[model samples]
Target: MPIFTVAIPFYNDQNYLSKAITSCLHQEFQESFEILLINDGSSDASLKIAKNFRNCFPEKIRLINLKENKGVGFVRQRAVEAAKGDYIVWADADDVQCPQRLKTIRRFFKENPDVDICLHDCYFIDKEGRPIDKQLKWPKSFEENPLYFEIKRNYFFIGFSAQRAGLNIPFRSRCRDFPEDYDFILRALFKNKKLKLIPEKLSHYRIHGKNRSNRHSYTYRATKEILEGLNLSELSKMLQNSSCLKEKEISLAICELLMTKENFKEALEKLKNGNHNCFYSNFMQGVCYFFLGNNKDSALYFDRAYSLDSTEPSVQNNLGVLKYKMGEVESAVELLKNALQNKPDYLDAQRNLKVASNGRNSLSITKKPLRLSWVY
Candidate 1:
């Protein structure tokens, strides 16, 4: 058995598979590793590409060909089980590992036997496996036996060592659907696996539009699934199901995140059903209404908060500004003046008051509030 077993679950990624496979075959530690290519039901020329790898590196490459496509998670899990190396790893079929990735990951693992998993940062790449212009900083997990709950929440911090990416990056999912990588990570993490992150960017992640959307949608669906499978979910679910204020807060936060990067209509449905509101949401809703020219509805929500909370001068200031924009000068003056009285130096209130009292519509000040400003 090799010291490192690399598993890749491939589908129809013929365009970049050569780069991914060649990267592994030419690794500096090539003598000490084996590449297990799991052909998870590729309908394209991917299988043809795999056959080429086998033909060229017959001794070093192993292929698992399935007649049907499986989801990424199922294939990945199987790849792990099939691994014979001391360390098991995964790679995305289109990703490229830096020259030193294998060397660094192996060294890290040799020195830290307690670490079950280690990953490094990756630069987002184009279809050609070249680094794209943008680069993202990798997040590091906390030390001191950080809770898996916290770790899973910071999934962006996670990475699979280069060795893992070569073989297992292309996984087969039994679900006959894609988005299995998320499921694989969730399952492994939820089991309290030990994972370490290296902050250096050493891999190239490819960008494919369909892959991107499917990955995001899968993440949302899988996260919701994980929440359901959580042993501590009773507490979280209670918050979702309760009528209390904090419960409403938690419910709204999850709903909003779920809505993010998703269909807005679906998000609106969730908001309507939950009947939850926050100052920011109310503010945003009012802004949306204002843009939609639904001034009456916009003013209503603003006033609804106005009657509900008097301590938040910022909200009062917003209402004053909105009224001012709608040509209710006297009403705006009253609210703005009231905001100033409540928080004497709130800059927004002062600035809006200045613009309103000046009796002309011009570009408004676009900045955050400060505690010190004159009423002008």
Candidate 2:
């Protein structure tokens, strides 16, 4: 088998699929690898573009065209099933991989036979392909656990946003959901698999209108679907024992997951003992109170949170909404303005501020922008 299987999950992406394929064809490793293209019912010219790769490199490319538009998740699942390389990697259609990507990952796997999955630091570029966004500087590497059992972030074996995580063949299952991407990586880690890291920035994560990160609601729904399928009790216990996370953070993570489902009551309960100062906890508590029409308590927690931290656009976001509802439009505008000033990339702040300001020239708030919580 080739040392790597580079899989691309694509839909109506004729404009970029060719660039992705050409990048794959020019890997720096100059070693054996295969490109498995999963075409998820593209109504555009994507199919023809992908097929052309076969004509150019018959031994290196294969295409799978589905009958209908199922979704990106399903497309990836199919590609994973078709992949034959000892190492399986996913590349989103619009993103371009550096020529050395395969060589870097391949070297890691070769040096560490125990490593099952590998990923490199990544950079984010704009829609115009400008390197004006995210820069990959992996601060930690995974070595604490047997690597196979550690579901980690920061440290090497950082949780693959699936930006790049490759598993050895004989894989257990395909990722059929959004949240499943996170859980799937965890499972792959523990299936007697280890993960290695390539610190160099070898991938460019293209951020554009159709990027899944932009569709928070759709991604969250997929996450809900996948999370609901897992054995929470079993998974929770498994997480507790793994090297992937420490106790407090994992519990907070579980609570965060529950909050996404809008199980606010359960979320609040789970967070009662959570040590971390989670803005989500305060936000969920506010949500629970808001739904109950306990505006006073809701306001109280939101105020406390706003006072505690304001860096996270989410907190400032909630605080702004609360202020607006409380007949403090001016205050809401100020809060959101503060949020925007802190992080220009925050959509919630920009959206809420524009709506609240109604074309106002300025928002006046004296408080310094607060530090944001790390999680939503």
Among these predictions, the greatest lDDT belongs to: 2
Q: Cα deviation of 52 in candidate 1 (Å)?
A: 1.5
Quote each prediction's TM-score.
0.59, 0.73
Candidate 1 lowest-lDDT run of ten: 366-375
Q: Once model 2 is optimally superposed onto the true structure by TM-score, how far is the C-alpha of residue 347 displaced, in angstroms?
A: 5.5
Off by over 4 Å in 1: 138-174, 212-215, 233-376
Residues 1-376 of candidate 2: C-alpha lDDT, one tens digit per residue = 7767788878888878888888888888877889988888889999999888888888999889896877665666676667777767677788888888887777766677665556667777777778864454432424444332222221322222222234443222244234435545555554545555656777777777776555655654554554555445665775677766678766765665565456667766776667456555566566666655676777777777666665655667667767776788878777787777778877657777776767443322211123232222
> After aligning candidate 1 to the native by TM-score, how far in Å is the CA of 87 from where it should be?
1.0
The C-alpha lDDT values of all candidates are 0.61, 0.63
lDDT of 2: 0.63
